[model samples]
Target: MKINPKNGVDQLVFGMKQNHVENLYGTPDKQFKDEDGNVIYLYNKEKLRLTFYEDEALRLGYIITSNSEATLLDQKVIGKNIVEIKTELPFKSWEQEDFDSTENHFNESNWLILQSEFDVIIRVEIGAIINDNDEFDWKFKA
Candidate 1:
């Protein structure tokens, strides 16, 4: 499935309500709030976690996947190193951050974030695009 940056994964867009997603994905294995109070819907079978922003009526904020079969720009990303992932820089640029030695690289232009462990990408996330007002871009609404 193509990860549409600032839009969503496949047909699921950013401003879609939880019920809309549930209609397509069925019930999540678990639904709860995160430390920051963002609603989270976990699908253990798919190894996917979806985050929703509280300010936007719980519309999807981002998608996190550890699925080994997932690909970015038609290239396998999970388990690949930064050097490998950069073989073709899909975005213009990205900013790197470190947490407890774990590396996180994010590009605001495309809203993609990669979390790496031991130099290997352990997870990939695509988030909602924020507008000039610092709000989720509801343009992708269903």
Candidate 2:
């Protein structure tokens, strides 16, 4: 399935299925049964995660990496439930002390939707990578 660059998260979730997801990302590293007897597939690579619940994709995570650590680029919710996203990175940075901490260096944007009494939130962040560049050359949908 083709992903709409303007709304990549939505396109991903809508296009995902058991066969399509596995074909694109390959077989999951681990698989197990949940309490409800549904199968859950987990793939934890350096910068990618494709999780499936009950043979349906529940979440997809893609990480963007720099010289240091990697930051998640895309996260999509597929189930009929609410989910929360979080990061352990602090909110402040001490540039004066050469600490270059994540605190105060994180930048975030989000898209939220409420449909059929279910809420979905897509959080996008640039992390420390944004501070290193004076300008960005992203091309959005026209």
Candidate 3:
């Protein structure tokens, strides 16, 4: 899968509706609501989880993949260590989570986040970028 920072992963652009997603990937292996009530659709075999905003719009707000084949900026990041990812992506200007030193999640201004566990990347996620006013600026409006 291809990752586009602040936009989407592959063809799943931000703000797409449920039907659009279903059309592209078929039904999810499992579907449930997260703690915040957002809808989460998990594709077990792909190790992909898509989160949709809860409202009349029900737009896709997040894309996450644990697939080892996923790539970002032409660099394969899954299963790589933080140091390797930083070097490959040349992860400049990424803001590290300061709340806990043990946490290895790093987020850029664009909202492309690399989540690591024990120094190894376990997940790659892309979502809408926060605007200057601190509001989500969705790339698509469908």
Q: Pick the candidate with the highest lDDT.
A: 1
The top-ranked prediction according to TM-score is 1
- TM-score for each candidate, following the candidate numbering: 0.89, 0.31, 0.86
lDDT (Cα, tens digit) per residue for candidate 2, span 1-142: 2222222232234224556557666787776766754444554652333333333233222211111122223333222232232233222221211123212122232222211122322222221111236432222211
Cα lDDT tens digits for candidate 3, 1-142: 8888878988888888889989999999999998888999998877889999986367898888988888888888888887778776755777666334334455667677788777778788787777889777778755
Q: State the displacement of the C-alpha of residue 74, model 3, in Å, after optimal TM-score superposition.
A: 0.8
lDDT of 1 by residue, 55-74 (tens): 77788878988888777777
| lDDT sort, best first | 1, 3, 2
Q: Model 3 off-target regions past 4 Å? A: 98-102
Enumerate residue pairs that collide in model 3: none
Cα RMSDs, all models: 1.6, 15.6, 2.5
Kindly report which residue stretches of model 2 are placed more than 4 angstroms away from their true locations once superposed: 1-15, 46-51, 55-142
Question: Model 1: how large is the Cα RMSD against the reference?
Answer: 1.6
**Which candidate model has the greater TM-score, 1 or 3?**
1
- The list of candidate 1 runs beyond 4 A from truth reads none
lDDT (C-alpha, whole model) for all candidates: 0.82, 0.31, 0.80
lDDT at 35, model 2: 76
> Comparing candidate 2 with candidate 3, which one achieves the higher lDDT?
3
Q: In model 1, how large is the Cα lDDT of residue 111?
A: 87
Model 2 has an lDDT value of 0.31
